[model samples]
Target: EDQVTQSPEALRLQEGESSSLNCSYTVSGLRGLFWYRQDPGKGPEFLFTLYSAGEEKEKERLKATLTKKESFLHITAPKPEDSATYLCAVRGSYNTDKLIFGTGTRLQVFP
Candidate 1:
């Protein structure tokens, strides 16, 4: 079975605080790793895609990296407006348009 799991369902951070969130997975032949950020009552916004090990992507204060078995999303110097839910999904060789998603990590940045 293909699956994705994210740690620390919710995180509280002070403005300018930096931290990293974990995204673990178990899948059959990973085609891609996707990262998304979702705000309250809205759809997820695409963040990054990792296709292979050692590959990394970044935007603003966010960085994503992938490995053979897992991926990570790192947040740097977070601000209050950055508070949102971060979701991870995996595309497997056996599934088509069926992205296996994690529960998501909710981040709360306090200014």
Candidate 2:
């Protein structure tokens, strides 16, 4: 079985603030890890794909890093426009394409 857990269910930040969100996970057979950002009512937008330990990816104000048992989403200089729910998902080697998703971390940035 594979599982993902995100900390700080919600976060509030003033404009220009930077913070990091944690994602802890466990999987039977390691495969791949993914990160996404979703708006209030929209589907998750792809952020990154981590296939090996020590792998890292970034986009704009966000950076994602992966390890054997966990991942991290680092947000830098966040603005109100950056507010959204960040999600993490992982696929195990045994699974087809189905991914186990995390509940998500809701981030609110205020100006």
List TM-score per model, in order.
0.96, 0.95
Runs off by more than 4 Å, candidate 1: none
Model 1 over residues 1-111: C-alpha lDDT tens digits?
888999989999999999998999998888999999999999999999999999999999999999998899999999999999999999966848789899999999998
Question: Who wins the TM-score comparison?
Answer: 1
- Which residue pairs collide in model 2, if any? none
**Weakest ten-residue segment in model 1 by summed lDDT:** 91-100
Question: What TM-score, to 2 decimals, does candidate 2 have?
Answer: 0.95
Model 2 CA lDDT for position 83: 94
lDDT of 2 by residue, 54-96 (tens): 9999889999998888999999999898899999999965848
Q: Model 2, residue 75: what's the lDDT?
A: 93
